[model samples]
Structures are given as structure tokens and as C-alpha cells.
Target: MSDQESSTSTSQTEGEVEGELDEEVDTEMEGEGEHDSKHRDSPPLQISSFSSTLRAVIRIKQKYHALKKRRQEAEGDGALTGATGRTSPKIFTFDGTTPIALSVPQKKKRKRRRRVMYPNRGKRRAPPKPARSRAKYCLYLLFAIVFVQVYNAIENLDDHLLRYDLEGLDKTLRREVFGQQGAVEGLLSHLKEYLSTYVHNKPWCCPCTAPAGVGKSHLGRLLAGHFRSVVETLVLQYYVLHHCPQEADALQCARDLSALISEIVERAEEEEKIPLFIFDEAEHMHGEILDVLLQLVSSEQTNEYLNAIYLFLSNLGHSHITKHMLHNSSSTSMAKSGRYSHFVKELTPILRNTLEKLHVLWTEADILPLGLLEKGQVMECFLDEMTREGFYPDHTNIERLAGEIEYYPEVGGHEYSQTGCKQVVAKVNLL
Candidate 1:
């Protein structure tokens, strides 16, 4: 019971302490509430002083900017006055204070634009061409073919029978014959006439007859040399008596002659050139061969492009010609006549008869007898031969040789050249 009483006293003391602590706390709370209320009741502290200060700062900044602008303007004016020697305007601030200078902003420079380059930009490609026409292609092909054929023909020209060894003929003429000016001139005139006849579209023939070694072949050569430019080919075919094989009969001879004539005619047509065919030692040709040659020349096929000269050199009927010359020497009437013209007139009939007998189709006008070499001509020929043989004989030796050469009237008659100037060189050599 004492313990319970003690417990109650302690509890009562504890409550009183608690109540006192509560009261103190209430007072503290009231004081704090009053303070807070006073603080809340009063108007919020105004920031007007700070706001006024900011305003002053802003005004100062504006003034500073104006001063700086004015100072810059004054400096610029001073610089202008110093440079130009002129009076500068005064720059002053509105507030009348010393101006402050500020840095001026610099303008930026612009960059230059560069040209851009691309690979192959400047190159231009050509447009594709149109197709060629068939006609043009065909024409080109034809031309190519023709050109090839012509080139081949020209390359093979040496293989043709019409082609001859001109160098050999030239050598022979230079070595074997000399000094027959009259004969050469007469032959040239005949050739010119033949060319004129062809130009006039007339068929012509030249039949030259003379004794052996009387410059008949030589005259033909001269004619060839003169007309080389005019004639495409100058063919000389020699018919050597007893030299040709026995098997070369009349038919073989005709065929050979025909082939040669055909070649010449073909060449003439193809080359567009006149041809001259010389038959040397023509008297050795068979009668049948002559007939074939005549037929070939006169044929319509040949005559179309056969603007050619057929020169036949022969020894036939030379005796008759010489006899006539001898007769002219004896008879005053014949002597009064022109020798060549009269001889031509007289010899034509004999040539006609002889050729007709031989079955040749030739006319009297075709025959032209070659002139015989005179004594003077023989002497000149001897001198020429001596010179050719590397001998330089004086005038006395020349006169001696000339006197030593014998002349015979019976051989060709009328002091005709019996040896036909061929014996002169041999006789001079003997001397």
C-alpha cells in the first residue's frame, strides 16, 4: 500500500512537469505566430531602390555609347582635316562630358568563286554517219575492179608480142646504116601522111621496096624514132630467107603474121595509140602470109580501131626500078622528068602486078621505092664507118678510099648503089 502511494506521488509530479513544459511551448509558439503574422502583415519589401540603380546603370551605358560614337566621329574628322588640309567639325556629347572611344567593327571580305572543271567536258563526240546508197557502193566497187584489171594489164605489158626490144633496134641502126638524108626525109613524109590519113579516118598502107642493105630497114627505123610519141608500139619483124626453119610453111607463116597483127591492133585499141608495124625483109614472106596480113588489116573488125601503119620492106622488083632509072639516065624525055615521081609512076604498075600474082591485096600507091645511095653518100658512109671503127682518116685517105670503090651499072643500073652502102665499110677496112 505504501509503494502504491509513492507511485501515485511520482505520477502527479511528472504530470505537473509535463504541464509546465506544455505551457512554455505554447508561449513560444504564440510568440513565433505573432512574429510570423507581423512579417506576413507588413508589405513585401519593395525592390524600387535596385530598380532605380539598374535604370541609372542603363543610362550610363547609353551615355558611354554616345560618347564613344562622338569620339570616333571627331577622330575621323581630325584625320580628314590632317589629310586634306581642311577645317574639321567638332564632335561633342549632349551631356557635355569627355567622349569615350570604342573599337569599330571591321567588314569581312568576300571570297572569289572558282570555275569547276570536269574530265572530258570540253570534248565533243561526232554524230554517227548515215548509210551509203547502193548505187554509190556499186560504182566504187566497179571502179576498184577496173583499176585492178588495168594495173594487171600494165604490169604484164612486157609479155605481149607487140612489145619489142627498142634498144637492140637502135643499136643495129646506129651500127649498120648511115647517111641517107633523102631517104629518111621521104620515109618521114610518108609516115606523116599515114598519120594524117588515120586522123582523116582513111585507111592507108606503106610498101617500101629496095635492094638489100640500101637503108630500107634503116629508113623504117628512122620513121619509128620520129613517130614514137605518136605511135604506141613500133614493131619490126625480120623475115630472114633460108634462116627460118623448113617447118615454118605458108600456113604457119600466115598464122604467125595474123597473131602479130592482131596483137598490134588489140594494143592500139586498148592503149588508144596508133601502131606502126614494119616487116623487114618482107620479100621472104610467103604469098599466103601476105594475103593473110592484108585480110587482117582490111577486115571490118580490125578497121574500126586499126588506125595503124603497115610498112613492108622488100627487095622484090628492085631490078625493074634500077632498069627504069637507067632508062631515065639515057632518054632525054625521061631525064627531063622528075626522077622520084616518074619512078613512082612507073614502079607502081609493076608492084601491082607482082603483088597480085602473089595473092596480096595491095594497091599501086602502096609501093614506094627507096632511093639508092650515090657515090658521095657511099663515101660519107665509109667515113662514118671509119669513125665508128675508131679510125680518123685524113682527107687524102678519104679521097683514095672513095676512088677505090667500084661502081657497076649492070648490078642495079644507072650507077645505082650495087652494094647499097654496105660494101663501103668493108672496102675501107680492106684499104
Candidate 2:
């Protein structure tokens, strides 16, 4: 066997032996008399190792006194080094003399008149992390952080493979999007087939970009945390709110965002390349930032990353722009390509020409049509979120309310259905 494998095997055997020895030791050393004698007879090196493990075990045992035996066993097994000690496993390290549980100091009882005689007795709070060997403590802390990180990573991997244990946003969609019988099960299953023939076949390779939020953001994020893919999530804070960096803030942010994009792109592994960039709040981006991004997206050097993708999500809302600004061709959704009459109001011929060019260049034939959510769809989405948080909608109550409102004509008039059945529906008298 290879040295590494041999070492691993030895450790495993040692762990098993240590566990058995620990159980025997604990049984023998339950009493104070037996524990002291065991410690005295143990060689110094052995005693030190035992003590090191024992201190941890003692702390764990205290935390899990109800499951004292199990916690001690895990600590003995070296599995309960830290937090897991609430259920620490014990290894049976032994020369076979017997087992011993080391005795720790007991907590003192509080006196009834303590506050009266000594007002500040328990009032003096201890500081964070007691004074200790600075270097050793720091080293221990750093090691601990690394250990926990590795452990959590492994645990996450395990959860991802099992998928039933998937947590967070991706988890919810798994049964729907990726599950065997999920709602979008066919889509995810056939996704591989579709990917073989999927997009970016345009002759103009400048931006092989798909519409942001064309499911890329969700796909990326889900992939990152899942086993089947790399860190697939796109950090798309920019796209969600179309109105980022209002007025004065807009020009500056739009320019600087290129730097942010560059930093993230550089840090991301090439194998996990981002094919889409979801700039959600494009309206807020400085024109310069948008320009730089367009350059990046269009570059041949940028698209080789097989493991990564770029997504830009934007609300595509025009609520904050001026009337003249809105008239610019770029202001309309890409899905709407026909020239609007209102677009002729631009004061600056240069800006107008630039906007027209960009609008045409960006939206040409490739734009995905907007698929606005139906009222029921929006309600279902809200209900799903609430249900996840333990707040289910009362269908009977809502139906009753709807019926009562419909019975009263002045509530919302004949056109009530088009306006929706929200709370204020009953108060309208615009007629």
C-alpha cells in the first residue's frame, strides 16, 4: 500500500483501539480514587496526549452531560475536538491498564446574601478569550478555522450528492427544477440535450450574451453550491433593481462597475467561466461601465471558461428616467423593437444617435420576449415564499373575500378583474 494509504489505515485502526480502551477506562475510572491512580501510572507523554484529549473531552462532557457517555466516546475517538463535542466521539488510546475519566474543577455555588455583602461579585464580566500563550493560541485558532471550513465543505458536498438534504434557494428548486418528477424535471433532464444545440450561434460574436435572468443567475448560484457544477451563482445585485445609483450617482457607478466585473472575472477559475453577465440595474450603471462590459462580453478571450458563466439581471423598469431620456430607443425593452413616435424628443443629436445605434445593436433579433407574470403566478410566488417561512395562505378566507367583493358592484366596477383583487379594490369609486 502507498505510504498515505498505510498511514490512513493505521490511524483508523488506532482510532478503533483507542475507542475501546476509552470505554474500558471510563468504566474503571468513574470514581475519584481510580482516576488519580490511572493518571499517576500513565507515562508523561501518554499523560500529556490523554490530558490534551481529556481537557477537550471534559469540556464536551460538561456540555453534553445528558449524553455524557456518547460525547466522551467521540472525544476519545478524537471526533469531538470542538463544537461536535456536544456529541464528541472518543478513541480508546491505551496501554491497557484500564480507562480513566479525569476529574475537572467543580463550579462554586452562589451564596444567598452575596449581592448584599459583595455587590459586584458576579457583576464583573470576564473579557473575550482569556489571556493565553499568544502564538500557540493564535495557531490553534487558525487551525480550528481551517478545520471547520474543510469539514463544512465536505458536509456540503455530501448534502449536495444526496440532494434531499439540499438547503437554501437551490434546495427548493431541486425538487421542482432538477427533481426526478419535478415541475421542470423535463427541462433539467433535457437540458444536456438542449445545451449541445443551445444559443450563441449568431454570426456576430461580439456579445454571445443571452438575456440576463434568462435563468442564468439562478442556474449559476445553484451550480456553485451543488455537486454537479462549480460555484455557479452569479452575484447579480446590480440587475435586480433597475434603478441603481439615482441621478448624480449614475454616471460614476456605470463607469466603475467595469473594475468590479474585472475583479470578479479574474478571481473566478477559468474552467468555471461565466458566459453571461447579469447587470440587473443597467439603468443605474455609468455609461462607461456599460461600454467596458460590452467590450468584455464581446471579447473572444472571455468566453472559453467552460465552468463559469456571466449573468446580468435588470428590472428593465423605466420609472426613474426623464421623459426625453425615455424617448431614446435604448430606454425601451429589447423585446419591443419597432420605432416609437415618442423617441424623436431628444435635445442632443449626438446622444440621440448614440442611443439609437446601441438600441438597434443590442436588441437586434436576439432579444427574448418579456414574459410578465400573471396575477395568479405572482400570488403563487408570494404564497410559496410565505409557505417556506411557515405562513400558509388561507384559500377559503381569500375566496370568501373575493365573493363578497364581487357581490358589491361599487367595490371596483365592471372592470374590477383587470385591476386585480388587492385590499384597496373595495375602496375605488373612480366612476
Question: Which ranges in model 2 have alpha carbons more than 4 Å from their true place?
Answer: 1-229, 232-236, 239-244, 247-251, 269-272, 283-286, 300-308, 314-361, 364-366, 400-431
- Clashing residue pairs in candidate 1, if any? none
Residues 257-295 of candidate 2: C-alpha lDDT, one tens digit per residue: 666666665654443333234444333445556555555
Q: Please report the candidate that would top lDDT against the real structure.
A: 1
lDDT of each: 0.60, 0.39
Rate residue 74 of model 2 by lDDT: 58
Per-model TM values vs. the true structure: 0.51, 0.33
Reference-based lDDT, residue 134, model 2: 79
Strongest candidate by TM-score: 1
Weakest ten-residue segment in model 1 by summed lDDT: 83-92
Clashes of each: 0, 56
Return the lDDT, model 2, position 9.
47
